[model samples]
Target: MALPSVGTRVTYPAGDLIARARVLHVEPVATDDGERLAVLLDTTSIHPVDAGWPDQPADAGVITVIDGAALTVLDAIVAATDGETLHLGRDIPVRKGTEGWAFVVAHLVDAGSAIAEGDEVETRADALLRASLSRGHTACHLASLALNRALADRWTKDPRRDPLGSPDFDAAAIASSRIEPNGSVDRYRLNKSLRRAGFDATVFTGEYGADELRAAEASIDDTLATWIAGGGDIRIERDGDLLTDRRQWAADLEGGTARLFCGGTHATSLADLGDVRVRLELVDDDGTPTLVMTTRAHAPS
Candidate 1:
C-alpha cells in the first residue's frame, strides 16, 4: 500500500535474469544530476549497487510495463525507508537491519516514465553483461584467497583467518574493491598500521622487493590454476530472499568448502570461470604505499 516494511525480495543471487514484480511505490527523486523516478518493486532480479560496499555495480536492465512499453533502467541503487522518509545510497542514515527501516532496491528510470504505483512489471537484466560480471566477481574472490595464501608467511603475528584458513591479509588490508566486466581491481593500503600488525613489509620494500613480488605473483597464479583445474562448484547460499538477507559465495574446492559473505551474483560453477589470473602492482597513493591487484578472466563463451 505504501513503502514496504521489509526488504525487497531479490532473485539475482539464484542466477535469475528475469523476474515478475509488482510496483509498490513510484516517486520522483532529486539527484545531483537531476530528477529521476525511483520505482520500488515487490521483487527484483536486477542487482543494485550496494552503497556500503559499492563493489559490484548495478546490473544493466529494463522494465516492461503492461502496455509493452519498455522503460530503460538508467541505474539501480539500494534505497531505504523508515516508514516516513525515503533515502537513497549514501543518503541512508541508519545501518541495514535497523529497528524500523526497510531496505529495498530502487530502479531509476527517466522522470517521464509512465509506470505508476501498483503496476505489474517484468524486469530483465542483460544476459551477456550479467554473465561477464558474474565471472569477474567469482574470479575476484578466488584471486583474493590465492593472494592471501601467497602472503601468509609474511604475517609474523597471528591475524584473523579467511574461509580457507589462511591469514586474512585481504580482509585486513583491503581499501576498496571494484568488479569490472570479466575482471576486478582491488586496492590494499600498506601503511604503518599493517607493519605494526607484524606484516613483514620489509620484504616488499627491500632491495630484492621486485624478486619477492614476482615470487608472490607466481605463487598466486599457480594456486588459481590449480583451483580452476579442479572445477570446484560454486553457488550462492542465502538466509532468505530479501535484499538485506545474508548471502554467501560458497565454493566447493578440492581442499574444502570456502564461504565468504557476499551480495553479488556469480557463476554456477568453477567451469564457468574460464582462466582466472591476477597481476600485482605496488603503487603510491598520495604518501601511502598501496598494493593493487588486478584480476582478469577469459569470459565463458
Candidate 2:
C-alpha cells in the first residue's frame, strides 16, 4: 500500500493488554523464499523493538478481528517514515528526527492473510511474560547504577557521570546488555581504551568479584528497599503517544529520583521488584579482561 504518513498508536505504555484499532496500512514484505505481510494500525498494545536500543524484546501477543478470527502477531518492530516511504527496522536510511519523518510500529504477519486496510483489529500482549520482562529490565538498570557506585573510588580521573552522578563505569565499558525473563546479563570490556578511561580491572581480574558483587547488591537492594518502603511511583514518562516518542523510565526514590532515557516497559514501583540480587564474574578473553554482571529478580507474591 502507500507509505504511512504518521506513526502507529501504541497502547502498551499504560499496561494495556489489548486495544481496538483500525488497520491503517498493509504491505507485502518479502522474506527468504516467501512473502510476509506488514500491518499498521491506528492503535495497538504491542511493544515494538526500537531500532536504536533493543534492551527489552517485543511482547508476545496476537491480533484479532471483531469476528473472532485471530492472526499471530509474529513480530513487531519500530518502523520509520520520511513521508515519501516507510522504512522497517535498521533499513531506515536516516536517523530519527530527520525532519518530516514519522516513526511507527510495524506489525508483521503472514502474507496473503485476510487482514486488510480499515479492518478493525484487536492487539493483545501476554501479561505474564510482560511482567517478567518488566522486572528484568528494572533490575538491570538498578544493578548497573549500583555496580558503578561500588567501583566509584577506582576511577582516578574525572569521567562521565551516571544518573546518580558517579563515575559512569557501566556506561563507559559496557560491552553488551541483554535482558532475559526475570534476569539480565551485562558485559563490560576491559580493553586499552577502558584502561584509558581509568577503570580498575584488578577488582574483577585479581580477586574482587564475589565481595564487590555482594557489596553492589547490598547498596542496590538498600536503595530499592527504601524506594519500595517509601511507596513512590515508578512509571514510563513519554513525550507523545506515538511509537518513537522520547520516553524515560522514571523512579521516585524517597530521597531523590532517577530518570533514564528509555524505550522499554517497566514495573509500577519497587514493590513489584522483590528480592533482587546480582552475580559478578570475571572472564579473560585471550589476555583481555571482561566483567560479566548477571542480575536476577523475583516479583513479590
- Which candidate gets the maximum lDDT versus the true structure? 1
Candidate 2, residues 5-79: lDDT per residue as tens digits? 777877687778899998888888865547788888889899888767677888888889778579888888888
lDDT of 2: 0.81
Q: What is the C-alpha lDDT of each candidate?
A: 0.92, 0.81
What is the lDDT for 175 in model 1? Answer: 97
Give candidate 1's whole-model lDDT: 0.92
For candidate 1, report its TM-score. 0.98
User: All predictions: root-mean-square deviation over Cα?
Assistant: 1.0, 2.3
Relative to the unseen true structure, what is the C-alpha lDDT of residue 267 in candidate 1, on a scale of 0 to 100?
86
lDDT for 51 (candidate 1): 88
Return the top candidate by TM-score: 1
lDDT of 1 by residue, 25-69 (tens): 998999877899999999999999988999999999999987768
